[model samples]
Target chain A: MATNSLPKADLTSSGRPVFLQNEIECSILSSVDLECDDIPNFPLLKSGLLVLTTHRLLWLPDNSSSSSSSSAAAVALPLSFLTHIFSTKKSVKTLFHSPRVRFQASLDSSKSVVMTVVMRGKGDTDAFLAKFWENWRARAWENDVQTQTQAGVGSSSVSGSGPGSGSGGFYTREGAVRMVGVSGILRKEQEMWESTDKSLQEAFQDLNALMSKAKEMVILAEKMRQKLLSGSNSKSSATNDDEVGSKEEMQDWLLSVGIVSPVTKESAGALYHQQLSRQLADYVRIPLERAGGMINLIDVYCLFNRARGTELISPDDLLRACSLWEKFDVPVMLRKFDSGVMVIQNKSHSDEEVFARIKALVTNPDTLRTGISASDAAMTLGIAPGMAKEHLLTAESKGLLCRDISPDGFRFYINLFPEINTDDVYLVKDYGIYNTWVRVASASRLE
Target chain B: MRRRPGIGGLQTAAAARDQYRLVGENVAKIRTDMMKEQLATFRTQLEEFARKHKNDIRKNPAFRSQFHEMCAKVGVDPLASNKGFWAELLGIGDFYYELGVQIVEICLATRPHNGGLINLQELCILLRQRKSDREAVSEDDCLRAISKLKVLGSGFEVISVGKKKLVRSVPTELNKDHNEILELAQAQGFVTVEEVERRFSWTSGRAIDALDTLLDEGLAMIDDGHRDGKRRYWFPCVSSNSTPVADT
Candidate 1:
């Protein structure tokens, strides 16, 4: 709690704290205060949000509840600093008082001090304390530190001892199970072979075992990704294209399962949807970017559930979470089209940008002849066909495009609705997209 | 390029002159016979094409529409007769006639509830309920069949009352104002003078004038029981009676 002792909390635009690499949020407690008994210049983190993560204990001023807390900077106390956690005391005095958690942490210059976390709100205080202890013992940060120092060669042997570590990487778990400290180079080769053998044997295991194994599976996947990344960076030409392709597929599958610390109903309780919405806003930035600033709600539902792995939320829950985004000042919105199809889009997503793309697509010489189908736009826009259809329809409604319903399929053309002189249907403009369309459409006739 | 004869009569006389001489008449007859033979061959080819893509024509609305376009180009109106060559080949003419007859049955049955003004989508739903799932019809198909019913002198026609398509079975000539009033009443089952004025961007006089006509024709009911004294025009024809009174 000493002044300038703890690292500053990096926050997302929506005021949620930015997690460290491979870090995940575990629990949240509101209206919490962090205080140190001995330190004089300790920052007064009074009645703020307390977030327990795999790597750090983050405390932020609850800007969502109290506007006054906006000026108070967010702070993080890495779990690495903690020396011991005190047990809860039971008494009549404790019942009348707010829940309190005490822990000793060595701050800057190894000066260990006693810090008390006072939970003033009616959050699940006991659950927060229990997660605090569990996270401290799990020591995910220590594993990360070990992985870096070892260059991940002996990663499979030691990190596999952690709870739920059996779902280790396909490379590491199969390769290094029986190997000790031989030559570091020889050990990796041995580990790879062992992993291959083990994977086949473990293929028929019960799902319950695999359920427990999933957590470590994520860690092992991360480790393998790190190794592959470093391998690519150092020896790009040496790695075979086949190897990189398989690695990429493995990474993608593993990355989908990367949201290790999903905000569960049991964890957030009454504030489940609100917290989920905030988390979702943070989660969608990368996906939104990938989808060109917007994605259908159905696609989002699948991606979110896939990312959460075993912690799958219901569609109703996902919808409620999306609906709660409106109440909060988030950077994403849930938009419902005229057709009742819903999508999650970036707040900055503009129809002009999409229309410009559609205009470009429809006005192309090839597209001018045949017109652009929804699937054609979907492929070009890197979006789902249904979503592309919505965009196309929106563009159509805006008169930026017009539809041609025919035997081939439903398609869109750059809107000639305005440029079209209905008084003379046969009159050609002699210029513009409409003129181009006419020329292209009649090219076959001329031939 | 000018001909010496008066253009219309000259062309007619030239046409007759060819038939006057025996050789000229015989040559003309052969040409006419050849054109007829080509038309017959074209008809047979079209029938084969229809037979080959029968399921496509039946299942895909867009495909069926394309086939219809082709038929139109060849002066072949498949829906013209029930027992014609096209009907024998595809039975599409029979299908539409059956659909039109069923639509007539539905319109009369539901006429009391909607005052002979039924929503097109609702009418199609009722039609589908009466028929099997194999015969899935679209709005365009319904429109086509309904147009054929006009020959019966029954005012079975589709009208756009707002975004909803309303099938008006009665021969009540609905002007734009009356149509607007009916459409306005569609949402809430009733509309006051103020509501109509706000909706159609009309003045109070225009709104009252339209509402008065509807009330006089008995197409709409007058509800002035409220304490506010605002005259509410409720079009029983378009209003399906689901909306509550307080919505106005």
Candidate 2:
């Protein structure tokens, strides 16, 4: 591990970065080499996917190979420790060689080492280098840690020095500002507004300027969301319901405006779908749980696109991404109904289980008499009617249920078809769905 | 005068008297022809009465029963009274409504549209005609007609109707419409005012009002609505096009 000087990362069970509460992904790269010549036993850690977040640089192994069978491990480098980055030397020798970046940092008091990042994959090396430089210089991690500590300070105070203050010696006298109490909070807000105004004015100056400020805008949105969350929690009783509702809506809007780390063609390149596939696997878990372990592909598309904010993926992309889940050890799988509608369902979600429940529901005297519509099933199943329809249809296909179309509406009944002997429809034998249905249906008809 | 000329002797005079009597008889025959016209008129009136009574025999149950008794008295067979014959005399109108219902069901199941499809108008017209008829359509007649229609034969499947009713067969084409409507309704917890408007291309408020009518009539149902100000309407399912409001 020491030999693999590449920073390590923590991944969720589904392979997504276990982002700090407010931390977000910024950019991604593939087939990168983080080499420290000073460390002898460092792991080679070659050709892995690198994700840059607000707080850390994360690396994950390429999953296309059998090596993925190795324990799901990731490496991360806390952006807080980054010191100086060396600019690329564009000599004839460097021009002929693979694009590389060199950075120097001290891991301990005893020594500091120069790390070389070799870009072996086909990507915009220049763009990556520029972003890398910007991220390093922006000191976003310091702000994140500061916010994190402020969050830890409870609802009472807002003053705290950022974690990277050790490097504050580099700040010019004009950059220094001492903040304390309510006045300090107001002054900070003022400074933030002036900075935002300056950036807005600069952004209007040119398209290139706006593009440069895009990351800053995302950061600003994140900060606003965090501030709102903390504010809402602290003043929980002070705000009225209407204001709270609007704030909640605003919070939702802000939360969905961007995915701090969108897997882009620029980052993952040829492996875009694979990485996107993994990210989707991680993303769908919540919605899947909410939907009771399954969801329509179209629904997932909508939710996933919503969660991704502006980076809306196409249906084709979503389909391809979902298809890739088969090769991975993901918990969700794609399912196609007999009706040809596709859905995403948890692997553990068994139709037999849903069928058993539906069987119970339809066999109930009330449901047996009224017959359950898709909505009724949806209500009982705690799912969308669309999803419930799929389940009901599946049950229908399995001959576990049958459909009734009448002047009233379409509904599903326990498959009295199987229970009713075609030879004698009126012959409702004891101890069968047919007999039960007849008893209920007859009573209703009589009524 | 000819008889007098023919008479030559006293005996001949007797023969002449007989000839004159014959001529007088011919004149009387002409008078009789004039007088017989009244009898012919009376006979014509009797014939009209018989014709009117024939119609009465078919329509008026009492007349029919009396006529049947008279026919029995007169040694003529009376028409049989039974369910089968009654159904036959009622013709196809009795089954038209049921057929129309099945057609709508098939169309709805086969191709789901937002609404306002040209085919839907045609189907609605057909259903309206079936519904307007005073006679209740029998399910069997509808099923029979559907079975006979070549185009619908493959696509339609018969579903047993309620007790005492004939089985209603739906066309597979309606499945498509059902699916589309279901999908649209599902996407919205309830069919939204916007969705109704979009589907029907009706005025905003009108679409919502119409949807409410559909809801109230039990043709559709509201499953859920958005918490946001916008109201969503969910349909339990599409209603049978030919079903009377009272049936629901």
What TM-score is obtained by chain A of candidate 2?
0.61
Residue pairs with clashing backbones, model 1: A167-A217, A174-A194, A174-A195, A175-A191, A175-A192, A175-A195, A176-A191
The digit string of per-residue lDDT tens for model 1 on B13-131 reads 77755544443333333323333343334334444444344443333222233344333333222222223467435544444554554565466556445545677888888766534
Q: Considering only chain B, report the TM-score of model 2.
A: 0.21
Give the per-residue lDDT digits (tens) of candidate 1, residues A281-331. 888888788756766564455456545533446556778888888777988
Give the fraction of native contacts in model 1.
0.00
Calculate model 2's interface RMSD in Å: 41.5
Off by over 4 Å in 1: A66-68, A149-151, A154-257, A351-447, B1-248
For model 2, the local distance difference test gives 0.53
Please report the candidate that would top TM-score against the real structure.
2
